[model samples]
Target: MEESKEREKEACQELPSRRDMISNLPDSLISQMLSCLPTKEAVRTSVLSTRWKTLWLLVPSLRLASHDFPDYNSFVSFLDKSLDLYREENSCLHLELVIRKDYDDDQCCVTRWIDHVARHKVKHLDVECILVKREFLEAVPLSLYLCESLLYLRLHRVLLVGSESISLPRLKTMRLEQNVYPHEAFLQFFISSCPVLEDLSIVRKDDDNVKVLRVHSQTVTSLTLGFEPGDGHMLYHYFDREILGICIDSPRLKYLNFNDDVSKCQILSSFISSSVKVHLGGVRYMSYYSGGVVFSNQQVARSFFRCISRVKDLVISETIMKLIYFCMKVEPLPQFCDLSYLEAKVCLVDVEMLPALLESCPNLNSIVLDLTRPTIITEQITAWAVPQCLLLSLEFVEIKCCCKAELVGMKLAKYFAENSVFLKKLVLRWRGYVLEEDSVLRDLLELSWRSSTCQIEVYGPLKRPVRV
Candidate 1:
């Protein structure tokens, strides 16, 4: 009988302890743990136990998405109650609200929520409203512009009406994507208000109603500007408007990604650093069907190239390459004296211009060529002049074949293999299926290399290296 009693006791003791380990933590620690979760999920934890019921009220951060709730009223009610509880308990440091449904009926409520957060000394704020109807974009409250404690701010698809009281002194990073700005002067004023801004990204839509956008900041270090055009058929409408101009006067800028096709004239201040890394892609001035290049585009391309000529690293898109080809036809391409790394997408028809392009980058040490949209190779490949970098500084070359038939890519690879004297490594990435893999490998192996120590590697469609 005693043995049976002891066995029962042992089994009872061994049963998983019902004592909640997480609940024993202090209220501060529990609130911090809950801060990382969305407000809806954090509130759900209240049902776990009585101890967690009021713990979520002390969380210092709130992340709420409107789609998480079944109805709009429920989302608004939860957000209002949470913010009220937070105000009574603690200050919120971070707040992110993503509204995916239409909020036209409750636009005032949206503005009220933003004003409330701004009053609570919120440091980091991210608001994204994805409205299917373009006409019903929610307007951002003017009070948000006066948020003195803001350190980071990101807004998407919001209407921003400028106010003279704008001041975000502590804000360091700001991203305004697809937002409606009243005017270019308002944007410049808004940017000027952020005295310590460091990183800025502006993604413009087709009809944002702003032209000649000027980004003039002394403290900005990184800037990304892109234009998102509508469908192909609607591009003609956008092109009918006046050509846009972008003037950048940031002295401390180090990185710039300019991918806007809408802007033809780009002007940079003389204070731009020579060591800036630039990526020029998706910039074209010619019509899709027309074979003729615009004269204004040629001039703009030359001026743009001159602005970024001192950059150390450059990435060119296929459209930009065509623009360069046209620019070269008028005058020789500008010399990029400090350029060391280059990545470009070249069509098969423009393969002959690759050498001329490299000649402009005399100090280039590495190059990546993406051969896309391959056409038939008709003429002999004897038009290219030997570039200075091939004999001196060029060391690494990577060629990517994006089509099934890689005849042009193979010929270009052979040309590089026979020309680059100081080449260290050559990587050929065949992204298309090959019927005969062995023959492809044998053909690459038979190519004559100018450098005795050059190592050649071929990657098949599966991205695996092929060895003899």
Candidate 2:
């Protein structure tokens, strides 16, 4: 029985092995197959056999993702090791490098990586340039102009080259990102040099610099531009003398969008340029930088009233209203007073502007006052008497951050009860400490007396979900 078992085992072992020897596999075939898998998986195949060993070194493309590496230095080290071990099978490379670090390191390493890929005759490259450190001090050089063989390029969170030129002869598509600047000059230079370029998308940075970014690309048939400002620092560089501006010049621009602040960048009224007129008629949507900067002076506020026609809908910041009141000294309307919709940040001075503003926007209907600081609002709104106006289309009115002594709230409720002819709904969202509570209630009740016939909803302290 032992002899028989041994013979069977020998028979099984003697059978010609079906698996192909690693050394016998064609290098080209293995390399091509490895190229299809992930970089990690491709490298893991080397453990199978010695012939498969060098196959991963032939992967034509390398991707060192940011999320995969804990830090930039680690990613750089991994990249260096991978590149050092890379074999000739990867004659031409299609590399994508995305590093999550500061722009400084990106500025330093980008050129080196680009050069490495170019040396390997890389054809497709997608890289996310980031700063590792020295974020404010360093600048990225325009060395990408040397990648002649690159076919597709995407830049994100990278420094913008003011006017440096980039020529990618084989390049077909160039997508500038949304998060950071892909400077107008750099884009212009890139497009100008890429004669055969077919597709281009510049998801523009958020800024008010209305100096149209010149894009010269007749060959670019498909263009998508997010031309408006973003949720950038509205008050950033508060002390800086230079106000940021965005100027775009793309004659053949087809798919265009200009989205305003994402509801957070309360840039106040100064960001609006009355002298500037945008003639982008066929625009898909006029979205961004719409609200305003907080005006510190009444002159600025009054000027805003004149130009309110330019803005579709406005969230009047509290500061701007104060500025208006501070500057308000019984002035007449500026000129264009066709404002229809307004969301005010209620202040005492806002009352001063309201007389003229309401008079001007005769077509005005809805007004939302967003009040954050109860004390400031109380003082601000209390300072001015209610502007008398018989609003025709007026229906909805929301008063937030209401305190008892906020004399403006009582005045507003009283005024509306007296004058808001077409008024249908009013939400009084109030908040205050113990002593001020009764005063607010009394004021609201007084306003109610004015509008026994008008519908009023009072959200008093701890009454409704009228969070300040």
Candidate 3:
């Protein structure tokens, strides 16, 4: 009888009704969902629910890509309608353009739209042009660069003519993707122009005709450097395009991300200023680059970190962590390093190099270790590689991924109980695969350790989530 009742309950359990679900969703939630879709499709949602009637108007983000338009005139007409429709006084605007046009119609439309938006004073703008032919792009005036409300701007795959002519005064995030131009001349023009730019990213385009790519920027806080695949013939060309230009001169830069495909390129800061901090993701790679480049995962990590030669607060991917451990155990390292707050995602910590790297961080404050999806065996943690003083200045410790908390997890618990004098909080995030109720409870309870000083928080069924 009980089994039958359980089956009935299970049968009754279904996803919330679509009407009920739509009715219950808040305006903000609806707007956010609509924002991700194409602008036209997003606008069509007004008839879905009366509650969402005004939601599209309130959607702060507007993403209109030109690729889907039937013709240039259609794109221009839609742009005019959208600008007239979306009337938020203070909302972020995300404008991405992919114009593959040989005609002057789309070019004129783009400029008119940019001028219209600038007059409205949009908060955030990200502009992208996909292979915009030379003639049309050259005609765009410098007025787009003068907008004060633009917090973000991204230009991609466009012919950079009068490189010095483009400038943004209040840009917080700027991304230049897949652009090829003469190296030093390229940056001398751009860097000297943008006065208040903070976060900047430069990605080279895929072409052999381009010989050099030079980069120089001042007052940029966050930077991302990425590379596109180059034709083999261009590799031996007269101009040494092998050197990737990365100039992060911003005094307030706190985070950095790097990606490269050409293994031979020497990454040089055509010029670097002193005020940089927080290097994030020292190495980044494209799927094609991974196949062609000789840079081992370790070598890639090494190059990435070396670029951000300045500062603290770092976030590392699991792939990068694996490489860093390999390189750190190798022969040489500069004496006193400053990386203190490090966040890593990995199942197993490299025991050998972990201690040495920690030693470099004398004034380390916190360590956030996020476990990858596959559960790392508790016994495999290189706890001993962790220096004794690692937990001394550390105030917060977090551990994740436990099917059933075992040896390595226990070692971590004991380490905290014994060594952490100032340890205030310990967070354990639970994994989701374990199915049975009893087994889940047992696995969850297994982490509750024999500790007194630190306050422990388990992430599974018993307590609040580790994440806020």
Candidate 4:
């Protein structure tokens, strides 16, 4: 039996091994395999064979995260060893470092790591730091600003202290969130430094010192500006009521999201802009109850809508709905020839602007109206003529409201059912505020359908299923 086992083992060793097939792959492909793994796991592959021993060093991408290490000291040691070994052989195309600044040594290590990557020709760089102390004065190394090879960059919670001059020649996309700047000029200087930046996002925190934000990028296509307040309940305490102004002048800008509640907006240029699919004037739960923002009679929102009049797709929120309602009475809104889809909230006080708003969008196709609360339409409907969109372009209609308010909900539903010539589908969902009979479904089915192929579907309150 021993001789038989020995013979079988010898036979298996003599046969060609399957592991040799993977080992025979090209060095470039093997390095790519190591690139997809975490730095620690990639280094562990060294025990596989001698061919993979130096394969990790040639990886074009490196991501070192401190959370994967046991302690801050170990994390620093790993970065020192890995970056040194990687620098000797080849340069990296992408380098991402997610570090936490808990100790004083962490800032020094991060500075050195930034210096190392700048010299190694990193094309894409991202640094995310969680500052343990809010008042930590660690500034990003000035060497990072001079990295001409960067194509994409994103920084979060990193401070840019006094180093005003920035010259990133090849950068295209950049995002700075919770990053501290000395003043508004520093922010503008950092933005204007990138000549070829196409997509940019700036999120301002409560600690930022800038009062007025001015964007004058000629090449930016997508831009988002948001403000984070310090306190949730008390808006006047943390937010400056001085009416923050946002001046924009990007001719090539296509997508813009100005979702700040505490600021006033101003557009400098009359450039054609693309659409944004967002809830325009919605606030957080705490902000809603606090009643800190009031745009009902403000001209700031009017200017904002006038600038984005050429938008192809629009979504109006409750606050913006009120603004449009009030603004329509004073001045005529810009003709929204580019608008194709609109989602709006129809309330009691703002129903008068519905017809006027629909008239502005000559090319609108679909509309969704939320009639959840009881809207007291005290004034009679004045306009009897249907809009041009309802006759030619409008197709899909969806309405959501309470079942008890069927009288008011069906008024809009009957209008759509009788008017929409090209209507494709109409969906109505009714939830009950109190126990009431769901006669809406039966009544809607009996309405006169304008389109030949319009399908009507209704969903009532869901009933519990009984188990046998």
> Residue 151 of model 2: what lDDT?
84
Which of the numbered candidates is closest to the native, going by highest lDDT? 1
lDDT of each: 0.79, 0.54, 0.56, 0.71
Supply candidate 4's per-residue lDDT for 428.
Answer: 70
> Candidate 2 residues 1-468, lDDT tens each?
999999999888766453554457688877778878878778778787666766788667886686677766777787877776755555446778776664443435665666566666678777775433224322334456667777887766555545455557888888776433444455556567887777777665444222334556656655544433343434432222232333333344333332322111222322223222222111222122125443333343354345334434444445444444444445655543344456666544344366555664556667776654444332343344444335466666777664544455655656655666677777666665432444555555555343334455666666653221
Q: In candidate 1, list every pair of residues with a backbone clash.
A: none
lDDT of 4 by residue, 1-468 (tens): 999999999888966665567778898888878878887888988888887787788787778888888987888888788877776448866889888755764545656777788877788888887653446545678888888989998887767766656889999999887777888888877888889999998887666677777777788888877766532325655433445667677778767665566224454444646544434643432222246444343466566677777787776666667656656776777788888888887675566567788888878888988764575674454344688899989998887775565556667778888888999988776676442234655676677878888877666566321111
Off by over 4 Å in 4: 1-17, 103-106, 131-134, 162-165, 230-241, 262-288, 291-297, 317-338, 344-363, 368-393, 398-415, 422-445, 453-468
Cα TM-score per model: 0.86, 0.48, 0.62, 0.76
Quick one: RMSD of model 1?
3.6
Q: What is the lDDT of residue 453 in candidate 3?
A: 53
Better of 1 and 3 by TM-score: 1
**How far off is model 2, as Cα RMSD?**
11.5
Ranking by TM-score: 1, 4, 3, 2
Instruction: Using lDDT as the measure, name the better of candidate 2 and candidate 3.
Output: 3
- Candidate 1 lDDT by residue in tens digits, 1-468: 999999999888866554577889899898878877767788899998788787887877888888888877888888888888775337777889888764556533667878888888889899887653457677788889989999999998878876878889999999998888888899988987899999999988756767777888999999988876532426566555456778888888998887865236467444446778888777453443244634446676687788788888888888888878777887888899899889999887888788878889998899999988867764666456789999898999988887753777777778888888999888788767753456666787787878888877888777678643
Rate residue 229 of model 1 by lDDT.
56
In model 1, how many backbone clashes occur? Answer: 0
